[model samples]
Target: MMLNPAQARARLRKLIRGEERVFLFLDYDGTLVPLAATPGEARPSGPLLDLLARLCTCPGLRVAVVSGRGIADLEKLLPVRGLYLAGVHGLVIRYPDGEEVWREDRAGDAKKRVEELARKLEPLLEGKKGFLLENKSAALALHYRLASPREAVEVVRRICEEARPLLREAGFVLRTGKKVVEFCPARANKGEGVDFLLSGWRGAFPVYLGDDETDEDAFRAVAEKGAGVLVSGRPRETAARYRLAGPGDVALFLAEVLQDRSPDG
Candidate 1:
């Protein structure tokens, strides 16, 4: 059953109270920053960043921003010291204590392949107005949020007809998200990142918030061991145990948690 925003806030607080160590794994774009038609348009507000800063300071809490963005991009938005940042769908990770790692594919060919496609996509989509190509190391996203509905459909069809089959044959997969189509290598997903974060932690429950198909990986990971929350317009067969209507609700819910915290020293 889906929880209303108020109920979700209460539940999150209860979860926080139970855990000795609370790890917050959040998706960047939709979860933290408002989704913008252009990638560069998305940025978190000062109060929001301050709230995250405070959350990171919670004595027994461990927090991380696990995002689909490149590590460099995530860093630009959040300069919080000592917060673990995972990017490229968990294929790239930066630890809180000053360490970084990349998990490459078996043949070590994944990065080069994704990059090549990213370059090709720009030229392929050059004349198509209102479309964007977001090139992540492990994947590529084609955003059509600004396109007219008819144009978006045509563009997506062309992409599916041309790109999806090629990526699939190459052992990559295609996913459709909110006005966007994404292609990712099959080996890694966000779930792997969640597990990576919990590797040595003793009995820590997980809470992952995301608003897209890419996030299903993290949700699946949490559902398998702890819990998952889906931020969607309406529920489907997603791995989430709870749901919130939109980004505003997510912010309010997050703010509610911060307000309820016993004031820090």
Candidate 2:
């Protein structure tokens, strides 16, 4: 069953148990900030960033931003201290310890393909607007959110068709997200990152809150250890056990957990 806002808040509070060994796994774009037509516009508010900055002080509350963006992009979005992050769907992991690891080609290696595909895609569709190319490590995302509703669907289909053969030839996998389609190396996935994090995690509980299909792998991985909450209901084959309406609900629930000191909390 799904949780109402209050219940969800209460439930989250109970999970923390003041243990503080919270290995937080979070999605960046839609989870931290509202989804945008382009990745450039999806910026979190300063206050939210400040809140995260404060949480950095919570002892044992280790946080990691696991997302489909590249390492550089993740760095740009989050400059807070004491946070561990993995980008490009686990392809790149950047730690506060000044270590960076990659599961596939680094951002530099994929630049040529990223540039070439962006150029190729822009010319293919006429009278279509709002297509964006986001280059992650060994991955490329063609976002069509700025396109018209009808045009968006067509853009996705055409781009997928155009990308399929080339991606496979280069040994990549194709995945979809809210108004976006991506091609990435098969080595990078949320499952691998989550499992890897858990291998070193000494937490009694773990939670993953994501709003997209790409998050299903993480959801499945954490099912036995904790819970994964879905933030969308747009017809996905999810392994999530719970769902929420949108990002606002996510903030509200988290804020409540931060404030709660009840017996249930």
Candidate 3:
């Protein structure tokens, strides 16, 4: 059974209340904002931005947005202050201190292989409505959200078959989420992002919240260090110990967290 927001909040607060500081890591799409038919259309709303700004102001609270989107795109979409942003599944990290780190290894042979895959996939997806190919400098996402179920299945199968050899040779991994299949460097994952965000921090309680399969790695990472909250509409097998129905519940939970640190609480 999934824990409701209140139960999840109580448990999380219990686990972290003793810690000197807290590290809050979040996934972008489907977690902060509802998924959209096109990636370009999933923009952060005013309320989410305001909530994030409020969270950042909390004393001893560190916030990081860990996402599969490229760092540049995340910066453009969010434009919030005092928050770390990890993009391209942690291949790129922009710290709150204004320092930026990128896995340049992906820029060498891995990038070549990804480009080769893009050339191969682009031709196949042409003329197919609802099949969008997004080339996020660090990763490639094949979004079939608008494609019919049959088309999506066929395209996914073909890409998996065609890219399998290239990915194997280049040490790349294919990750699936919602209606998208993303090809990224094998070394890049959300777990690494969480590690990067918490590096050098002492005795900090880490909390990870996400709503995608890609988030499982992060769930396991924080489960070892602290906790993971799964945001979903239905129960599923996940490493996350707690759940919130969707982004609405996530907002309410964040509001509660903010309220707890307020003067009245």
Candidate 4:
């Protein structure tokens, strides 16, 4: 069962109050900003950027944005300094000090396989309206957000069938999210990213916020130690213990958190 917005906020506040340090793992799309028809259209607003910057400056608080976008794309989208970014769903991690780590270093051939699959998928999407083949270097995403539901379903089925052999050959995994299906490296996931981020910070309470199936891994990762907040308007089965209506509610909640000063203040 999902806890209501107020209940969830209160619980998070209480947890933060008790903990000396807090780590936030946030999902970019559909969590920080509303999902747009195209990924490019979902750019973060100035206020949201400001909020993140403020949070970064807050004492005893650390922030990381974990997303399926590539490191370059995430850096372009979020220009804030002192942020830990996990891009390609954790395949690449960028630290606050500008150090980058590629978790999938041994997957060189696997990446080639993904590119090959993208080439095979290009012609299939040539005549299809509203189909986008996004090659993220280490991953490939087919987005059909602009297509009709029936059209999207048929296209996804066809793509999956055609890509099955390549997926198996590359040992890649398919993940479905809001109007998108991604072929990613088997070991690349948000859970591993969260675990990696948390490993350095002992005794820090971690909270994850996300709104897609890809985020489920992260929810489970933080379940034993902290809380997972689901950003959705409708009820659904999820591992998240709390719920917020949408991006607007997320902004409100974040603002409230900033207003609630730490015990030291």
True-structure lDDT of candidate 3: 0.85
Instruction: State the C-alpha lDDT per candidate.
Output: 0.76, 0.74, 0.85, 0.88
Provide the lowest-lDDT 10-residue window in model 4: 256-265
The digit string of per-residue lDDT tens for model 3 on 1-265 reads: 7677778877777766666688888899989888998988998889899889888888878888999998889999887889889998888889877788876555766667778889988888777889888877778899898999998898889988988888888788999999999998987799887887787586788899999999999999888778899999888899999988888888887787777654445
Candidate 4's C-alpha runs over 4 A off are 261-265
Model 4 alpha-carbon miss at residue 6, Å: 1.9
Question: Could you tell which candidate, 1 or 4, scores higher by lDDT?
Answer: 4
Q: TM-score for every candidate vs. truth? A: 0.88, 0.86, 0.94, 0.95
| Best of the two (1, 4) by TM-score | 4
For candidate 4, the TM-score is: 0.95
Residues 184-222 of candidate 2: C-alpha lDDT, one tens digit per residue? 778779878877766777664677888888888999988
Candidate 4, residue 182: Cα displacement in angstroms equals: 0.3
Worst 10 residues of 1 by lDDT: 256-265
Per-residue lDDT over 43-120 for candidate 4, one digit per residue giving the tens place of the 0 to 100 score: 999999998888887888899999999888999999998799999888789998999888886667766887899989
TM-score winner between 2 and 4, please give it.
Answer: 4
> How would you encode candidate 1's per-residue C-alpha lDDT over 1-265 as one tens digit per residue?
6776567767877876777766778888877777888778888888878878877776766778887777888888888876889887777888877687776544256666777777666666777889988877667788898888998887788776777656866688787767778787775578888888889575777888888888998998888666687776677777888777677777776666566553643
Candidates ranked by lDDT, best first?
4, 3, 1, 2
